[model samples]
Target: MEKESGSMKSSSQTRTEGSKEFEFTARDFERVRALIYKKAGIALAESKQEMVYSRLARRLRATGISSFVTYLDRLEQGSGETEEWEAFTNALTTNLTSFFRESHHFPILAEHLKKVKEPIEIWCSAASTGEEPYSIAMTACEAFNTLTPPVRIIATDIDTNVLNTGANGVYSIDRLDKMSPERARRFFLRGKGAREGQVRVRPELRQMISFKQVNLLADNWGVSGPFDVIFCRNVMIYFDKPTQGKILDRFAPLMKPDGLLFAGHSENFLYVCDEFKLRGKTVYELDPDRKTSSAKLRRA
Candidate 1:
């Protein structure tokens, strides 16, 4: 699915002006691009200069640092407060998600559920705001025809702020506007009186998922795998080919032989990774012919 990076103005022209609150130069933006890539594996484009300035400016304001260079120097030197790095990373990360985004994938997942054994494990690799993982939980419920399905979903994201939101499992009522009224009534508890227009996911759905902060680029993701399904949708587009390949290599080892990998509608893993073969629309399964470690382990 195409990600929307809301309206942006070019930073090229803004560089010539002197009206900005913070002194954000081309080099500052470059430093940010480098640091984030090293820390999180995101490849920021030159066109994102404007977006960078706007997002990081809030950090400057919060930290009471008047200049981008000084703030960046602190981060680069690792002298800033321990939480500042978390804050900086959070400021730059973009999260755009809705319930059952890429609707086609959910039905595919539902069918896959029937074929798999009980006590299935799923990893929602980019569980922004909990919508995607909750959708998975809901799908599991529907597949088994029960509110308490034999499923466990581990929802992860790099941004701690969103992970916290997801763990809360609350959202504005409008987020479910597109869903069938029956589905909405079954899965969510509507807010009343003072809490009207807000809804919280049913406890059963919340219990099915565990939200955590995970940096995909790290040597250790801190999550044990061999997951039956891994939903890494709309995430690879943020990475360059090399980073994408590395992540995919890591993914293969953590998956069961027949486990399915669901990617974004727009992502194509066919050329980037040899461990998997395209199984359906942006869906991938371990390539039996590839002789990857995971496949070999499964056969052995």
Candidate 2:
């Protein structure tokens, strides 16, 4: 039976009689694509048309706008633009990550920690929902055999929503599946009573991290670096080569001489940037000589 009360459900959300579907034209899509790229360095392909329509349709509903064209007009005319733009960018951003998603990198990080006798600072450039930064904290704790290990992590992302989540340091119990039980016990506190089946990052682990919302394409990252390790994984795949190269160039000066840069498995910087040499699988270090390291150069 159809509901008697009307709600602002998206038109494309479901198929029903007499409900007007939002008109999304090719011109509208192109306009949106252009706007997104200009605001954020993300390149949206033609195939993302449906996705664009679906994501923005909800925005239309919320704003009580009838069509995509009207919304686009409002957005471009600079009327209540700041909040709309923030919503637009947040809606389009993609963040998929898990605890120890790239399992191998953690061990390498641990080894890097062991070798570095001085203080260590790490920048997690795509900290989606806190797992990656918390994992870094756990690894540091294990490597140093202390809760108060001397390490600092700056976790940043363009999405304000996810940064808030990361700062909260809370997760469903199942988020720990990929992690070993021992490590989970060490770093997370299991919730009780009303919060059962959830875990929160232990105070010690939370203390090591600072979460912030940062757009990587911006002129200033707002965080001091010269970091020992930078986890910029699974983020560059969305950008074109030129954008990737520029970001890499910006990253080079912010890291130590032997600092490590971790890339996504699908990302290969060999063709894009000369500032970093591939030190291991998806791992890179600054290459002052600009000579590409051979694949035979094994991981330490």
Residue range with the least summed lDDT across 10 consecutive positions in model 1: 1-10
Q: For residues 143-259, what per-residue lDDT tens digits would candidate 1 score against the true structure?
A: 999999999999999999999999999899999999999999999999999989999999999999999888998887888767899999998999999999989988887887779
Q: Best lDDT goes to which candidate? A: 1
lDDT of each: 0.90, 0.85
Off by over 4 Å in 2: 1-20, 290-300
The clash tally of candidate 1 reads 1
Best by TM-score: 1
Q: Please list the residue runs of candidate 1 whose C-alpha ends up more than 4 Å from where it truly belongs after superposition.
A: 1-16, 295-300
The positional error of residue 165 in candidate 1, measured at the CA in angstroms, is 0.7
Q: Estimate each model's TM-score.
A: 0.92, 0.88
lDDT for each residue of candidate 2 in 83-165, tens digit (9 for 90 to 100)? 88888888898889898888889899999998875789999999988888988888899899999888999999988889898
